[model samples]
Target: MLDDATLRQLSKTRGQTLERLRGVFNAGVGGDRIENMLYRLIGNKDGSRDLQGLAEVLQGRNVKLWVVSAGTNNLQKKKGLVDADVDKMRLLLDTLLKISSRTTKMLFSGLTYRTDIGDQLVDEANEKVCLLIMAMNQEFGYARIEYLPPVADLDKGQHLADHVHLNERGYQMWAEILAPRVMELYGS
Candidate 1:
């Protein structure tokens, strides 16, 4: 999750004031999957109590950058439907791109390794995610959409406590890695 403190720190580091806009609907629902997100986006389901959909949130707003971090929950699903997941992800990205302005920069965070899950399953899911990133970059072009790599040492236990979620130090490290790229894009 992109915390407020990290965004504030990023603003200070970049010497540019940045506003945080959030549109989260379902929170802490283990059953939340990519299909659910797609349905929410299409107005089939209520995405949030306030924000209707992702495009609706962006509509009439001054958005310069969009960062999306999803697919982990989808990958964690028991039934492995990598292709379906990737297709849904592509549709989401395409929808976002259509709704976003031409100058809006987009960043897609890649899947991180989960230690709590089976090693082979995690590896396979990450591989599919990497492929999805590659395909998205090719379709969107490198200049418009960028793929942020997973944290280098997720297995080291210093950053992650549950192996699924990040601890305070992990969040700090994530901010450190993400803020600079955001700054660079803002500057450009």
Candidate 2:
């Protein structure tokens, strides 16, 4: 139901209806909020971290902090758990550390919950992700690597806008959960 093909088909079928209601009930009326939410809804780690400018940006001496908070969609794609998935993540982490400046401090948060993945599997998969973080921390001991456990409670409907992407309150709550860690590393 949450696949790209499905979304494209829905857009095709519903395009006329959306156009008809554009003046009265347009999502873009407010901003790109709805459009951004939809993109994040289908955001999976199919081939994440293309690393287009990763090395270039982090190579700078002033690039001190790298806060990475993503990977819930990996679970949607049945990733971040299996052996192959672990291998790929580890490689990415390793590359990230290697390409980054020596002084770069990384705060890597674990996976958040997806409505599609059951709670049990989410926990287990996030545990695997945590292990990868730990391994990267061990290997890249020169730089600080802080790992926070998975973001919880997203399965609860209040935080979700469409049982998929987070709403305003949901994003605020996520920021609240990470504010302390960000402040700790980033300072006031």
Q: Each candidate's TM vs. the true structure?
A: 0.69, 0.62
**Residue 139, candidate 1: alpha-carbon lDDT:** 71
Candidates' C-alpha lDDT: 0.62, 0.51
> Tens-digit lDDT track for model 2 on 4-94?
3322332344212212211111111122222232343223445764323334434443545555544454454453356665665565555
Residue-level lDDT of model 1, residues 1-188, one tens digit each, is: 23344344444543344454354222223335667666666553454554466566656555566676667767654544377787888887777677767787777766655665565665676677667667766776666677787676665467665756666666556666776776677556
What candidate 2 gets wrong by more than 4 Å, as runs, is 1-52, 76-80
Look at candidate 2 and give me any clashing residue pairs.
none
Hey, what RMSD does candidate 1 come out at?
5.5
Kindly give the stretch of ten consecutive residues in candidate 1 with the minimal lDDT sum: 21-30
lDDT of 2 at 71: 49
